[model samples]
Target: MLIQALTPADKSPLLALARRIADAGCNLSESRVSTIGTEVSLMLLASGAWDALAKLETALTKLARDESLRLVHYRTGQRGNSAQLPYLVEVVAADRPGIVARIVEFFAQHEISVEQLNSTRYRAMQTGAEMFQAQFTIGIPADIHIAALRDDFLELCDGMNLDAIMDPVKF
Candidate 1:
């Protein structure tokens, strides 16, 4: 199941929310929380039986209403478990729009899928140049030629004047 919650950027509400999920017998398989400005956003994946899910639904509803938190919850069905190789790709370049889109399109053209991506843009402390950086966790099909892929990726990065690296993701 997938659960998303938005609450005040305080500690108590989140603790209460976690307790509520636990009391309903749901196990949090994966979760991520981030603060955007003054609000805290949470995305969680909980696993359990239907009855426990029902209890969790009730608890979440009450938590949202009583605590003034905004939330959404639903069953997410099955997950993707691929036999593909996992790799981490990192790119850094001068800040510019469409960098992410262009890189994603390049991956799509090669039939690769991105499982997770984190990107940020900031000014370099010393150089004062605006820079963009992205780290992507991608799944490469077992049949793909890793050497060829790396070469092609490097060539593309060279054309874009970006610094990048692609390597296996270690457990």
Candidate 2:
């Protein structure tokens, strides 16, 4: 397993690494790529020796020079068995930059972990304005205060002038 953190500016480097992993006869088990502002994180799970990923590291290091891309972090190991907690949050509003950052920051501050997030944008027929909607599946610790989370989220929505709704979901 090779988990890499990178910037979106140097996508080619990531592609190159992926190709190398494939060529090294490794089976790609799981891969996820996401970005918030200029920061991009890639998590990949593969079946093979960690040594098979050495070349990938060197290639990414070189590619980071001119692109100002930073290899934020990497881990080579297997995952331990664990349990997951489930919660869901969804928001809809006019599309604009910084929305993701703001929401993610709030989650971070609240010590909330997002398991899955899907966001989309389109023009609204009535207003012809860019409308955005985001759905987030989060992991809430057993002790987290749900009512507090809801109140805070509503406050955030009011500040952002957007509509936000959070609910306890069965997963």
lDDT of 1 at 143: 93
Q: Residue-wise lDDT of candidate 1 within 1-171, one digit each (tens)?
A: 788888778743667767877999989888888786688888888888899989988888777775557788888887778779999999999999999998999999999999888888899999999999999999999999999999999899999999999999999
List runs of model 2 lying over 4 Å from the truth: 3-25, 33-43, 49-75, 78-84, 168-171
Candidate number of the best lDDT: 1
Q: Kindly report which residue pairs in candidate 2 clash with one another.
A: none
Of candidate 1, the 10-residue stretch with the lowest lDDT total is: 8-17
TM-score of each: 0.90, 0.57
How many clashes show up per model? 0, 0
Per-residue lDDT over 1-171 for candidate 2, one digit per residue giving the tens place of the 0 to 100 score: 555656664452567657756776666778887776666777666566556566545554665564545554355667644454577888899898999889999989988888889898889998899999999998777677788878988899899988888887774
Q: Pick the candidate with the highest TM-score.
A: 1
Per-model lDDT = 0.88, 0.73
